[model samples]
Target: MKTITFNQKETSPIALEFDELIPDEIFTWEKSDFDSYMVPIGNSKFPLSNYFDVEVEGTAESPAEVVMIINGDLGRVKYIGAKMSNGQIVANSSVDLHCGAEMSGGSLLVNGDAESYAGREMTGGELTIKGNVKEFCGASYIGDWRGMTGGIITIEGNAGKQLGECLTGGEIRVKGNCDILAGIHMTKGLIQIDGDVTRWPGGQMQNGDIVINGKLSRSLEGFDYQEVITDPTISGKSFSGKYIKYLGDIARNGKGNLWLNAEKNRYLL
Candidate 1:
């Protein structure tokens, strides 16, 4: 695999956008070409040579053959690898917003936290975040009906509000807690939360699956209480506990499934 490394020389005084430097566009560029490049910071473009040292090694016939490594504090850098079709990207630090928006293929791994709109409108591939993420993780843009169409996002830590909103396809597995309205308006897909939920999950979902294994602070009145079942199979995975099934977002005539843990949330029984 071809590798491109970015080592920070100085942290950006203004936030930089690294969306344009993905494997799809820079696969053919050499180290010298990278040295002369300028990355967009806020509203202006600054010479990338001023912030990080660049090194591009090996050769690739396609973006899928390339591997991009960003090794520095990227908490102020937004859009690290947005809309990439094929490649392997690894960010060793926290990243700003839109980390993997509208992506079609390949894989992206953020070793730290990510801001809002991570994995928005993604059609295929994988995005893994090792730390907590802010709002709108795997959500669609405002007024849009479809969010991620394909792909898988696994957040190893807590996630903010509106996770996987308006989702069409794909899967999101959050190992930690999540804020409100998770999987809202989802048309298709699967969301698994291993931790507690704040409130109103699957608020208006038309069709999809949301499995909450932990406590739920509140549930929407739009859902009708279905019978509790044991060893429920959600999205092809058998969970070894009793679950309360709910149907409707009756407000939208939605038939999506919201499975809440009966053991953890016994008050609702």
Candidate 2:
């Protein structure tokens, strides 16, 4: 396997764009190639060597054989692994916006917090975030109708608003709290949240499933209450406790399913 390591040496006020540095594009690049490469920052370009000490090791015939590790403060680095088709990327610190936006394949593991658009419009692969994520963690771009169409996003920490906005496919599992409108406008997909939700999940969803294992602050009137189920299975995953099912977003004539833990949401019963 080929390994590439980037250790941050300096911090930039303007975010350094890294959409061109994925394993698919740099699997065969030598250290010298990285030294001469210019990185985009704001409206200008600068030597990547000025901000990071790069090390390339081993050989690879394909992008799937590559592994990239980035260490140190990368809070100003944008697009850490955007549009990658294969390979693995590990970031050891908090990342800026668009961390894994538009990725078609491969795996990205962020050891710390991630900014907005963590897995926007992803079609395949896995994205794991160890800490909290801001707004639009797995949603569509501004003015775009398509969101994450495939893959899996696992968030160990809290998620902000519009967690899976406009989702057409894929799955999102949140181990911590979630904010409002988790599956708003979704057409197809599954979202599992293990923590409390602020309000209004599946607001305008047309077709999809949202399973919330925690308490919900409020539910939208657009969803009509359905019968309660016992130890229901959702999207092939089984739950031990009873869940209350609801269907609607009839405001848009949606047929999405919303399941909430019966024990946690007694008021809804």
Candidate 3:
């Protein structure tokens, strides 16, 4: 793979948007090209070279052959891999909003935390976050009905509210705790929460499956307890536990499968 590295020189006063510097667009560019490239700030444009030292190694004929490494604190950078169709991006520190939004192909790895809207409306590919993510991760964009039509998002840490809201396809796995309204209004896909959930998952969801392997603080009235099964198979994955299955977001007259660990949610029994 052709490797390109961006080492942060200094933190910017305002958040910098990285929608333009992704491998799909910059894989063939040399250092000189980056030096002259204008990156969008809040409202104005500034030379990309102002914040990072660019280093390019080898060459690539296509974006898929490129690997972008961003090393340093990018807490003030947004949209690190937005809309990329192919290639790989590794952000080594916590990133700002929209880190991997609308990506159709490619892989994005955030070694640290990510802000809201990560993987919003993504159609395909894989996104892995090693740390926690804020609200709306894998959710739909504002005013958009479809969220994350395809792709897989694996978060090694917690996730905030509305995760996978309005989702139509794909999968989301949160290894840590999750906030409320997960899989809200979702029509398709799968969501697996390995830790605790605050409340109200699968709210108004019309279709899809949600497997909660940990404690659920509360359950919504929209669901109807279906039955209990031992070692239930959910979304083609075998789960080793006594699980309570529920069907509905009946408030919307919808049918979605919600599985909760029976031992952790005995109150629902």
Q: lDDT for each of the candidates?
A: 0.91, 0.95, 0.94
> lDDT by residue for model 1 over 35-134, one digit each (tens)?
8898888778889999999888899988989999999889898888898989999999999989999888899999999999999999988999999999
The better candidate by lDDT, 1 or 3, is 3
Please list the residue runs of candidate 3 whose C-alpha ends up more than 4 Å from where it truly belongs after superposition. Answer: none
> To one decimal, what is the Cα RMSD in angstroms of model 1 from the true structure?
1.2
Q: What is the lDDT of candidate 1?
A: 0.91
Greater TM-score among 1 and 3 belongs to 3
Model 2 lDDT tens row, 62-126: 99999999999999999999999999999999999999999999999999999999999999989
lDDT of 3 at 8: 92
Per-residue lDDT tens digits for candidate 3, residues 37-98, read: 99899999998888999999999999999999999899999999999989999999999999
Off by over 4 Å in 2: none
Runs in model 1 deviating more than 4 A are none
Point to the candidate with the largest lDDT.
2
Candidate 2 lDDT (Cα, whole model)?
A: 0.95
